[model samples]
Target: MDDLPRRPINKEREVDVNLQVASLLGTNGQWDVTKLIHLFPENEVTRILHMQVGNVHDRDVWAYSPHGSYTVKSGYTLATKLKEAEAVRDASEFVEVLELKRLIWKVPTIPKIHIERLNTRGLELDTCCRICKAAGESIEHALFNCTMAQEAWNQRSLTDLLTAYLKFMPDETIPFAQRKAIPWILWAIWKNINMLLYADTQESITIQIVHGMNEEEKKWVPPLPGYVKCNIHSNWRNAKLHSGVDYIIRDQSGNVLHHARDALTFSPNRVTSELSCLVWTLEIGFYFKDIIEAVKKPNDWPLFRALLQLISSLCARFRSVAFEVESSASNQIAREIAKSVLCDGHFQSYLAFGGPAWLHQRILREAAPISS
Candidate 1:
């Protein structure tokens, strides 16, 4: 034991003597909070207490990859990112770029239009903007600089437009009627550009923009009689590593039966945050047996093995369960409720009989049927 290297209890602090991990465990094989409280901060103590203690021995696990196993592809990606970080003089700009990439995946626009750049370097294709025919056909020029695209965006630049869209569009605090049509406008511009270039047809950008905006305001459909629907949404913050899960259960008559919001810490990524939300819903007696069983065999997503197992065990209590994906507009209330943890500072977890008090009016309005 004396020959072995000692590990520090807290790396943030500099201490001459280090302690073994086993010293932190009590006689019952659980984390001894008494020892942790004396050595660590409150948040660290809480995190340590939340950790699961398995019967098996500990082993090495890779952190970079999702499956806790290192792969050459993942290694190369990490290496490239590290090299880029080292080369970039401005750290803030690099972080902003990384955040932009993360947000790009979450946007629900057409996939083809989401390409970061067009490869026109080696190709014999025309490099000028197809619509304006003035500037080079880069992503920025095509999306924002072109005369037609500028008209669609009201002459806003890409940075300003994206910033405004991300700030107000997805936020529930912004009234539905007051939200800008940035996403749809951007989509229409891309779509029209594609049609003109590929099909050699000139379509009215104004007409297409109107159609795209109207599509987002579609009414939510209720489930069939005798069946209930569950709408779930998760809000994740990358910087804080915190997540919030909000879910609403409604009957065929569009009446909300139950709603809940739970905040969690140390969520690794969006995928893990979503998986945690599903597990929370199941643990609270809202069974999704079909979906749970389907994901129980974690051959591909080994990072979620523990969560999947918990879900599988919970599913055994129920005979049948049904689930269907709900549109972002339909699930808007639930999504907002989840985001309230961060926005409204409601960080604590709670299971409520109905929708939250702050969003009571919005909930009532959404539950009502649209008069054709």
Candidate 2:
């Protein structure tokens, strides 16, 4: 028999050293401002304390001040209190909460396209959808809000699922966590929808949800309510989606936080031709949307105006390609009017993008807010 070598033993107590380090610098789970400050040297801490940026309070300094404005819980707005009601439907807040969740989870879930930019530029283009060329794409042009997505949602029984899931949630007034299940379910359904639209061919949303629910149930500690079906139709191939609008939102470091497809269509028949033409034209406009989102700041008004002109040119191009009709003279006039309004750059970015550009200009002219 060959001689066996003795295994060396660890005598330096590496595990104990690691524990000591963990105690000094909190673990990932316990990470917060105090935990972060403890890792810095006294001089560095002092420097941070002295660094002031006007009235904005620094959390590090505020931590030491006994009478600081920081509170464990902030007062809830009337809107916040109302959100708890299950029956109240506030689309704006729902979108905001979904965005907030995406931020919190560091997940790319919401569709945050530049609606203003898309409206300006996607007015023209000639690109056919790879899967289906019946329509092109733009911001307000995707699955959640558009017609094609509505078809898919109908096919997948999304409305029913959402309704059932929502029933289990706290109304508009409920806390986010209490209402989290529905959003999660919707998110999963949306993901499956995207998979069908982008990766797979002509998949039924219902089948995808059934399969998804099954997998989700296995992973859940306590299973969710809806039943999941496993046996998918063998003939249920994915549909070929030629053209669809999608939006991508990225962080400062160019990390994609959200991406969503608008819709996909295959119809280019005589009666539906105009609708398809309009849809396809929007693709050109999507570029402007992308630009707006990229330059998401207060000083991008000039860029926005340039985008409007670009949209007009694109729309004219698409109209020529599809209908052989000359570009709308009114659209050109609108562009000129837009330029005059933006000349001084004295408008709120949010309100500027919300209403009709002409209406916005009128408001500026009169120095008054418009009635709803």
Candidate 3:
């Protein structure tokens, strides 16, 4: 061991309550002993605790307003203080309760099988696993258990591993369905943790995890757009894409109202069950024409074209409207929309117009004329 230096001792301690109070009050500090007495009273421990926790000294009494000055103000009762304290305690307890819940459940609640991150306490900890709540929330537990997570999983179509788990808890280590969906399980756990922490919700943690799993499946087996397998002429004319736009109508308290969603549709199909690719394309083209016609100025064309291209890319593989193959109703709508686009005065004067003419004629031949 290395030699250490010895310390000199015997310094006298001084007590100056005035100096302490002066320091707390600073030069501008004031005092109201009567108010402090009134606010604190004789029996209440709350005022003492508040002073201790807030570190308020005699001189610091100036921080309060004249009416407040540590006294019971007119509007604030002891009940108010109790409520505030309860709110604080409840908030703290809420998170603790969730943690306790995880502990009660046997879910993997930690770092991934391979990686780890620091916990809120700054200690290097495993990411949560779903299998054991005490372990930290992980994908496995969230998708399989924890009430809410289980609900989402059960409600939708389950994968083989999940299905096996649902049917019966198996012996040994691996189950029937999990081998193919391990990553998905993990991702769900992580996503649910994030949602729980940041979104301030008590949503089914398991359902969130399952959603993550579904998202993973969606990635592997990307769904084909409706139009890909649909009858092109029917579905496109009856698409229901217009409902997708949900404009904000009012503030949370219903104060001010605003009208949004000014953009016109490129296609206005009702999205029936039987639409085909041809109908889908027709809707797209017709919607595009509508947007172009709605514009008030020539310069807006550039912006409109850019927006049209974006819509096209987003809906590229989306399932288009479906209609009965033998029904001429959808067919006529498609023709009329196309014809209107072709004959629009704006298009004739500037934009070159070309659409399905034969299909339009076919639809007209099959339709009954209407007059006001």
Candidate 4:
């Protein structure tokens, strides 16, 4: 206290800091996404909510890689795979096949001999090949090298499918994960072989990866009769405030009505970015006037407590105007546009336009068989 003078702290500065703290309830106590340009990403919040679903037992799985178990080697391998995959023609297809990645990552397969490694703890399980008996029972040996199982891989249907799938892929440049759908089938087969070797099971069945993709597809949904649907997407870079926002509007019958995408002027956090995109999307809908009926967004739309009230406000504005959420995957156009705005620094806008040319091709591809 000897040579120090005490004065009151600046109350205005305190209030300013509090306001900048980024609240769902706006500065004046209103919900506004643009005002709080910094929020957590929606997917992150969704995963958290999913975890909070309260399991009888808690389980943790690594999300960044396909194996659900993270390691330094796996991370490095995944980073390289992602970098290389960005250039691959069918890279999207590879992502759809997690089983394939789990099988191939770090080459967890035949030549490496997973069975011997399993017995390293001294389980005393026989290492001899169940099929050929010439060598140890390893993944590769059981699948291909073994004289008996060799015919399974050599089956005309499997070979023909592999040949047809590979005809569209480059042999040298593309990573093996992106090469063919055959690996998923092979991995399924490998898993069954292990079940027979270790677990007590009987049937040897085949699963076609290509056919399964079509069977379990969850693509964008069209609006119901007398309604208009819109998809929204947002992206925020880690450790940075700048974010990208995108939205696409379509009629009930699935005709594109309008679309717009832009980079945010401020870095509202990821959750905030998505909320802002949702609000911005609705605001744009207010422009469509009488013709606009209802809006449908991704099921993960309302994570924050404030969004429900904000959605309530919109319901009073027009007849049948409601914020509907669904698990259906929307057209990837908004996501593509948002990423483009982030990477290329371009503001994309379309009025009375079908969408970007790239999206048209993607739409066509989605219309075709099997989208990964």
Highest-scoring model, lDDT: 1
After superposition, candidate 4 runs with Cα above 4 Å error: 1-27, 30-180, 190-211, 215-221, 265-272, 286-303, 307-330, 347-372
lDDT of 2 by residue, 135-188 (tens): 544333443545555665565444554666746454665554434444444554
Ranking by lDDT: 1, 4, 3, 2
Better of 2 and 3 by TM-score: 3
| Candidate 4 C-alpha lDDT tens digits along 1-372 | 112222323323333444332344445544454433333344333322221111122235454432234578757656766665564555556665755645655583564356555466345677665545665566556666665456556652455446567474565555544455466566656665677667756344344445544444557666677887777777678424457777777665556666787766453245555655666666666666630111233222222324433544655565766554533344466677778887887765544456667678765554344323
**Comparison by lDDT, 1 against 3, better one:** 1
TM-score, model 4 to reference: 0.45
What is candidate 3's local distance difference test score?
0.35
Q: Evaluate all candidate structures by whole-model CA lDDT and list the values in order.
A: 0.67, 0.34, 0.35, 0.54
Residue 164 CA error for candidate 3 (Å)?
A: 10
- How good is model 2 by TM-score? 0.20
lDDT of 1 by residue, 109-205 (tens): 6423443323422224555577778744766777778888777666433346366766666778755643555666677778888788778887776
Q: Which ten residues in a row are the worst by lDDT in model 3?
A: 1-10
**Superposition error at 90 for model 3 (Å):** 48
Could you tell me how far off, in angstroms, the CA of residue 154 lies in candidate 3 after the best superposition?
4.1
Question: Could you tell me how far off, in angstroms, the CA of residue 284 lies in candidate 3 after the best superposition?
Answer: 18
Model 4: per-residue Cα lDDT at residue 341:
80
Off by over 4 Å in 3: 1-110, 113-115, 118-132, 154-193, 204-351, 354-372
Clashes of each: 0, 34, 71, 13
